[model samples]
Target: MNTTITSNGLPVLPQAKGNQNAQAQASQPATEAAPAAKADDSVKLTESARALTAAQGDKAPAIDTKRVEQIRAAIADGSYRVDAGKIADGLISMEGQLNGKP
Candidate 1:
C-alpha cells in the first residue's frame, strides 16, 4: 500500500508566514512608549500651527470706523432692525461646520 500527503495539508510558505506575523506585530499597541511626551509634542505642534496662521495676517479689507460707529448708534437708539433667529441659525451652522458635521 502507498500513501500520499495532500498539498492543502502542508504548512504555509515561509514568506507568507513571515508577512502574517509582521502584520500581527504591527497591530499591537506600543504602550510601553512615553504617551505624555507624545501629548506634549502634539500640543506644541498645535501652538506652532496657530502662530503660523496668525503670522499670515488678515486677507479681507479693514472695517470703516465711521460706519461701525453709525451702526452702534442706530442699535443704541433702538432703530436698527436685528434678526435674532438668523443670528442663532448662523451660529449653529458655524458650530456644525467647525465640528466637521454636515
Candidate 2:
C-alpha cells in the first residue's frame, strides 16, 4: 500500500480496493438499485433537545430595561458609582458557588 503524507504531515494509508469501490458507489447519484439509500437517513432529537427547540419560539428571558437605562444614563452623566466592597463580595460569592458551597 502506498502511503501519502497529508498537508498536516500525517501519513495516510491507502484504502482497500473493495472499500474504495463501496465508497465510490455511495457517493454516486441515486440509481435504480439504491433509490432508498439516501431516503432512509434519519435524525432523532432527544427530549431535552426537543424542549430547547420548543422554548426557542417562546418569549425571551426577563430583562430589567428600566434599570439598564438608569445605569446607562448614570454612566453617560459620569455619576455611576462603583462599590468596591459589593463587587468583592460578589466575586467571593461566585467563587464559593463554583466550589460547590451554599
Among these predictions, the greatest TM-score belongs to 2
Per-residue lDDT tens digits for candidate 2, residues 14-43, read 332343455454544432321222424567
The residue ranges of model 1 lying beyond 4 angstroms of the native Cα positions read 1-61
| Residue-wise C-alpha lDDT for candidate 1, range 20-101, written one tens digit per residue | 3545455443333222222233324588777876777795457698997787666544455668999999999999999999
**TM-score on alpha carbons, each prediction:** 0.38, 0.40
What lDDT does candidate 2 reach at residue 80? Answer: 62
Candidate 1 residue pairs in backbone clash:
none
Clashes of 1: 0
Q: Scored by Cα lDDT, where does model 2 land?
A: 0.61
What stretches of model 2 exceed 4 Å from their correct place?
Answer: 1-61
Clashes in model 2: which pairs? none
Worst 10 residues of 2 by lDDT: 30-39
